[model samples]
Target: MKLKLIRQTGIHVILAAGGALMLLPVIWMIATSFKEPESIYAFPPEWLPHPFTWSNYVETLTRPGMAFLDFFRNSMTVTVLAMIGNIASSTVVAFAFARLRWRGRDALFVVLLTTMMLPQHVTMIPVFVLFKYLGWIDTYKPLVVPAFFGAPLYIFILRQFMLTLPRSLDEAARLDGAGNFTLLTRIMLPLSKPALATVAVFAFRAHWNDFMGPLIYLNSSEKFTLAIGLHMFHGQYGTEWGPMMAAATLTVLPMVILFLIAQRYFIQGMAMSGLKE
Candidate 1:
């Protein structure tokens, strides 16, 4: 028991040290965001602002013409739409893959998984040209529309989770007059709430932090998401690290809060998804 206690203490200490190292950048960002602009360049940087101020946040929030609220609204719109699309489409695809029987189903699944190995850059030009031809350039459609097709990884995650459910439930429901659609909606969906929440969290973070997609598709300044909007701090002369960090902190806070709220679901979902029959 004493040996176990010592080993546990050593493990906890190592984990705590690693956690602090991981969080060091976050600590610096928060500290820098509160410091005055002139003091930001001070050598052997101040770990805490000597005279903390909200000016950085204030400037970031009230920057001329590029309203933070609008950027936030754009991000929220894209995130919500992407979440809905990914969930609705992926759930159906995953259900079919995990439960249904048909010729070539497993083979098709292998092909679908192969697509995951295809780098996004390899298809970027084609996708851009297709969207451009559709007159989707400079529009949210480019960012928002593709999500409805479902992501390969998300579909796989949901399918794996669904596979862990007992087929006995499906048989029992079938005896009670549950058709495929009814089984999916009533039985599968209800029990897969944790997995769904896991997917939502993943989708939310992806779309929320998505910079390259919006940067490539959106041309107009007014349509910028928060990720792009934060780039406004980089002027021709210099970058405003203070305001930039402030905006970044704001941008990252939601994801942290969301994970904290749903971390249990995330862990459980991941665990269940890893199981094999």
Candidate 2:
């Protein structure tokens, strides 16, 4: 009993130390956001500012050209739209792969999986050019449209989760004259909440922090999302570390809240996805 307790205590200490190391930067950012601009650069560095200045957040939200509200609205719209697209498309594709029997299904799945092996950086330029040709530049289309087609990773994850479910449920549904769509909506979706939540969380986070796609596609400042807008806080002469950190803290809050709310599902989905035939 003593040995087991010692082992568990050691594991927890390691985890606690790792967590603190990972969070140090975030903690520093938050702390710095509360410091006066001058104090932010103090030689010794202050872990806690004596006088906390909340004005950095106020300025960050109200600054011109930053258009923080517009950026927030735009990002929320894009993230929500992308989440819906990812969930709907991923669920449908996963259904086909998990339950349906079709010709060359496994081979086609292999091809789909192969696309995941290709680094996104390799295709980024080509995709940008394609979007430019389609006149999709300066629009949300580049950000939200492709999600409807389904991301290979999301599809694979959902498929794996679906595979872990009992086949008997699908068979039972079919015997009751339930169609594919009905089975998907009535049975699979309800049972796959964890997987769906996992996909939604990922999709939300991806587009929320997407700088490259927005930078390449959105030409106008008004159309810029939060990620791109935050970049403007850094001037060519000097960066506003205080306000920038303030803005970053605000930008991260939604994602943090979302993960906290859906964390259970995220872990459950990850576990289910690892189940094999």
Top TM-score model: 1
C-alpha TM-scores of all predictions:
0.92, 0.91
Q: For model 2, what is the error of residue 42's alpha carbon versus the real structure, in angstroms, after optimal superposition?
A: 1.6
Query: Which clashing pairs does model 1 show?
Result: none
TM-score of 2: 0.91
The backbone clash count of each candidate, in order, is 0, 0
lDDT of 2: 0.86
For residues 16-50, could you state the per-residue lDDT of candidate 2 as single tens digits? 99999999998998998898977898888989865
lDDT of 1 by residue, 1-277 (tens): 9999999999999999999999999999989989997679898778888788999889888878657778889989989998899999999999999999989999989977888677889889999999999999999998888899988777888898899999999999999989999999999999988788889888888899898899899877788888887766454214788888888888888878888998886677567546523
Question: For every candidate structure, what is the RMSD over all alpha carbons to the true structure, in angstroms?
Answer: 2.2, 2.2
**Whole-model Cα lDDT of every candidate shown, in order:** 0.86, 0.86
